[model samples]
Target: MTPSPESVTTMLYQHDDNGALLRTDLPFPRRSGKVRDVYDLGDNLLIVSTDRISAFDFILPSGIPDKGRILTQTSAFWFDHLDVRHHLLSTEVPEALSAQFDTEPLVGRVMVTEKASVIPFECVVRGYLEGSGLIEYQQTGEICGNRLPPGLKQCDRLPEAIFTPATKAEEGDHDENVSIGRMIADLGSDLALGLRKRSLDIYRKACQYAESRGILIADTKFEFGKVGDEVVLIDEVLTPDSSRFWAADDYQPGQAQPSFDKQFVREWLSTCGWDKKSDPPALPPEIIQRTKAKYEEAKKRLTQSEPTL
Candidate 1:
């Protein structure tokens, strides 16, 4: 059963021994993303989901407790259920490295994955109009260079799920949405179109499953990579951070809907009076607890399993 927000509040607001894992020093080569620190392990990669959370392209001063575990578990759930080629190999960190790193940091938060040559675009599938899509529709009545029917309100379901590709951004830079034509120019028509097809397929299947679980997958981003002649899904799958999930019972199309992700963090940041140019204000304890509850609720709804320590 899902834990209540009040029940998780105390634990969720407490910091990890290592506060907001900014980076990791491992024997292997590592690259730190906004929330993950990945270690390159020759033929495989060790992907560690950290407690860190990012907003407005900036890593926040605080993190939601157990966030790493929630994301890792949620992605593992989807990767296990999805009928497609993916890069996940195992969620276990090697026993040999057990002594090298603290078990607390690695437990339920790491994956040993088959490495692939990662694609440089984000394959975004949107089922509802919000965020950039809403903004784009208001300005030009289009999204990802695809024209939409007139008079679509905020959070309204699209005519159908649309695959909108965007160029992957550098650290601290914004990811810019690109047209299908642009994607074709960047990675050939065959591969670009293939990404779109796979993205839409995954989104549709996920939507059906999430709806059954009382969650609406508004949209999600996917990263893919080339392994020999085939492109397989890589990076994180549909976790709260990657997808916009709304409570199915409370969903309303005309306005922003209550969500089960970092929408709370984003909303708080938007009104916190911090200039985008400056360091983001630290998230209040209440905000942290609320965010943690959202991530946990998302995992519970989709997987219907308690998070393992």
Candidate 2:
């Protein structure tokens, strides 16, 4: 189940006492996305991942019940797990700010990151045949640059994970997948190579480990920023926001399988008659609850524990 766009928006304002999402009379710096409310705090960016859910690029009416928290906490988990000390600077986040602003307002979904100019690329890594990859395969017989084995069905795993890079666009703009060469042309060749190499490494490592844990990392997106010659991962990693996660136990590949992601929201939109261009339809309460649970389940499955409320 997924939420109606209206209902989802309605659900976001409510938060538990654990922390409150901080709002200000002074508006946040205005880089808007489908779900995140971003604030620029000097050298740090206060990122509040909201419960809002999007399907087909349209923000659905119903929010994924408690999705914001799951995304926030899940991102934190990955930040800590990777432990590379690159973009995340939660510790440096003002405790005073944390105390004054309602953290539970945003739940554990808020992050204070060292502000770096975001790389203009969406570092995509694919380890299976599905979604965009499947479409590309059926239409062109190639995904990114790799050819697939014959008889592969939807949701089928690939022989190996591959790095698929694309350009990150502004709100309402679609991210375009370009070859490494184009990436080099836009962002110097050296940087492009680094992004490609690192994107693949992260995906390879994360997917391999996730497989060991009974989760299939079908695909995931990564963002990077440079902190003096060091290429560090940025933005959200492995969440339903940026990745497609599948249950390892239920592995069947002929058609779309149940996923701990936005499957419901996507399905509902297909029947809504709303073109993917305009605002999407609101999800029913049942869909909202299911979508919310899907988020929590993904976080739980990945972290092996309940997220901090």
Candidate 3:
């Protein structure tokens, strides 16, 4: 059974004053990413989503309270609902490590997954014009070699969703958008085509369901991995951190639309006069609270309505 959002928030903040699990100390081989700490557990992996948040490729010092739990639970919701082969094995922490580590911090934010050879590209699907996609369209009338219809306004829904793949960048670097042909050249025709089809299929289904729940998934990126000969969806799926989610009732196409992700943090950072090069400044308490509310609202909206997929 899924716990209520209020209950989860209470549990998360009861112990820590800041209400952020910034990091985890585990006795396993670990690789810490921008927001998640991944520990290798022999055949499987223990992925712990921390409250750490990043923007403009920099990890911010302040974290949104309960952000990790929201992300993890949101991904778990999709993993259970979406009809796709995915890497999620379970959300429960393994029994062996229960005695060694404090389980309080890990609850609702842990995923035990099968480790697979990660595909080096981010499979991006866009149903709307925004972000880098909009900038590219304005300049060349295309995005990642997909020729978009001319005169498309900002946030305008595309006639059809398009698959745009990007090369995964190193830590603290940006992922470069590349053409589909480039994906085929590097990953071969069969594999590239397969990934594109899978990504689009998932996006279409998710878009339909999310729209019904009063949210529009403007765009989202997916990661896939190989387990022996089979390709499976890997990493977080359709979470606010990985996807651009907009309030359906409030959306307008002529200009930038309000989002449910870390856009507030980005907006704050953009105007705070901090150079994008150096260490990022800490977010104010109000920004943190507002950001946390946005993420919570998204999780509540998407997970509350269960539809036949």
Candidate 4:
């Protein structure tokens, strides 16, 4: 029988800044998120991840030692392989910040990128049945306006993956689902369809590659930004934290499947019995260890490169 993904441990937050929003040592950054610290240094963007861990939206009090390295390194692997036009600066950094931070330590996770006007939406591509797509299908009979085959189960593969665009919410807000009409109304029809198509092509290609590596890419998020005349893929791609990774050997359709990403964290939260509306709990050592291992294993298994975790 498949087990439920829930968590019992709590994620307590001692610090609000996870080295993303406001940095003291390096030049101040324009933005920070649960895991990434970003700087707009004119010619490039500098991203750094602190050791902070978060679950269910709460940043934990304890920080993992090498979590940042793992995140940075994996992104490097993706940026290298994607070959899509992107905004990138090496953490080799520019001559500017090279004085203090060593480039080698930030591999995979840290990216020096050309800053662009981030598109207002997140490009979510789902090649399988799961998560929001599944929930949406069960309720509305459609996913982001695309109808799905009836009787699809929790982890079933879709007839074909589809692109579902969502408005980007502020850091703590949830992104509401929008229809193709809604997206086209906001972004002209030409741009909306263009974004959707590009999203599908990238997702399909990445899904095939992940399958080859013995990992299943369920669904993943991507961000795009415009640089002058080009639209580029921004942000991280397919990290465990960003995407769902199912062990290929054990994947099944009718019920929830084992996920290499967030399975331990989710399980602990459920066992702890915290209300989803309440603040999240702190992660115990075992949970943290397992979570870290899952992230690293997913990155390595998919990319065939270690992510310094």
Candidate 5:
């Protein structure tokens, strides 16, 4: 059975006094993404998942407590469950860098991974019609340049999962969906075809597992990178931040479904009366608690484990 949110302990990193860690000043060279900070360590990279959350292109002022650890743990679970080759080397902080900060906060929130030449695409697969796909389909009867059968409504399950790849955007920009032909033009047919097949296979395997756990994977995005000559999975996999996870018991075909992802945060942001052009306001305490519950619930349900009380 799934565990209650309160069962998990709130252990904050000493440096994370604000409940959200906005940045890390590690001694090594690093680059920051939406939610992760990647540090270069020659052959390997250290990725630190922060409690920081972003919505509608703005990183909100407030952060959810324990959000980083939950995301890291969820990704680690998938990396272990899937049989495919991936970039994770160890979740352990290298002994070499132990003096950088309080290692306690880093535990369960950092990964030491093999560095690769990352592919520049968001390999997305959709099992249900929703999100940008729904918007595109409503307008063009197509998504990612592929036409589907007529009359599909929002959140309707597609006859089959579809591979719709998008180009990865720079920080603070939106990712733009591109056609297979465009992918071939940019990445060549052989590589594009390989990514498509690998993405669909992984999605199917994950979907089956999630369904058994009472979660529906509506859609998800994946990142890949080249280690030497082979393309291997890189970055986080199948976590709530990268996937749309709906509760199987509450799923409805014609309306937006309740989710175990940041949809809750996004929904609240959409209706909060803030203009998209200005800085996003800090999330209210209620929103933060509710959002954190969803992430924790997703992790517990998928792993089929009780919280570490």
Candidate 6:
């Protein structure tokens, strides 16, 4: 039987010491991403958000407690609240599989979705300057062909949200940023324009809502897929794992701001002296706890009250 949401939460906390679920063993064709395990269920896909965390294009040796639950539940919240066509069919595990495998570990971390031909590009929307965007701006005062005014500081809010798409890289590879013209050239003008409009609309609405809740969605990426000729949003939506979320109250434009995502992991990895080309180090217990807390806090603040959208 499917456990109640309350029961699932209880189970997650109780099972924290059992360690992060690094992998799954279901008897189905599966594809593992940096943090999710996708199982083919014929008509639909079963996506299990694992606790595995990746930084510098490498899956780290350590996992954060309850990280899977945070990402899955957070995405579920957005799927329900966002007014758009999406690939999510349900969050409940099918009875056929639940009856066969021990599903207690899957509660609050599984999504049953309609399988679609995933688009090859990531739809990235930025409302602020940071990350690779900031670096590119520093060098050429442009990001993915979008020109910006001079003297913009790091983390400064952009004049408006910009849709900067990137090629969805293979596992262990970096996603390369590209211009909208490139996207239009690759994927006809109509389809490319449609994606840009949809992505920007969703980002604007989500950012507004997030700000009202004391969080700033500085930037985020969305993935789309085609079920026949209809394009729909797929994959995780606005989760910390896919977005740069900052505390609205702590906003500062000239320097790097504190974020709710995996900043701690990246910071540690950068300062630990691990060469970017080699295997990353396991996160210390303190880093794990701090990272987990950031994710949990983001989930709580963003989903505490449902938006009217």
RMSD of each: 6.7, 6.1, 6.0, 8.7, 6.4, 5.2
Q: Against the unseen true structure, what C-alpha lDDT does each candidate score?
A: 0.86, 0.73, 0.90, 0.73, 0.87, 0.89
- Stretches of candidate 1 off by over 4 Å are 1-22, 99-101, 307-309
- Worst 10-residue stretch by lDDT in candidate 2? 17-26
For model 1, what is the C-alpha lDDT against the true structure? 0.86
Candidate 2: tens digits of C-alpha lDDT, residues 100-122: 44333554667788777678888
Off by over 4 Å in 6: 1-18, 305-309
* Model 5 lDDT tens row, 67-173: 88888889999999999999999998788777633455577789899889999999999999999999999999999988999999899999999999999998878
Weakest lDDT window of 10 consecutive positions for candidate 6: 9-18
Model 4 weakest 10-residue run by lDDT: 5-14
Task: For model 3, name the residue pairs that clash.
Answer: none
**Over 4 Å off, model 2:** 1-28, 83-85, 91-93, 98-103, 273-278, 307-309
Q: Please, what are the lDDT tens digits per residue for candidate 4 over residues 141-225?
A: 8898999878888888989888887898887778877787888998889888888888888888888888899988889888888
Q: After superposition, how far is residue 153 of candidate 3 from its true place, in Å?
A: 0.8
| Candidate 6: pairs in clash | none
Counting clashing residue pairs in each candidate, in order, gives 0, 27, 0, 28, 0, 0
Q: How do all models score by TM-score? A: 0.91, 0.86, 0.93, 0.86, 0.93, 0.92
lDDT of 6 at 52: 90
Instruction: Report the Cα lDDT for residue 261, model 4.
Output: 70
For residues 1-309, what per-residue lDDT tens digits would candidate 6 score against the true structure? 988866554543333343887877577898989888899999999999989988877888889877988998899999998999999998888899767646877877899999999989999999999999999999999999999999999999999999999999977678999999999999999999999999999999999899998999999999999999999999999999999999999998999999998999999999988997877777789899899989988998999933111
Off by over 4 Å in 3: 1-17, 305-309
Error of 2 at 114 (Å): 0.6
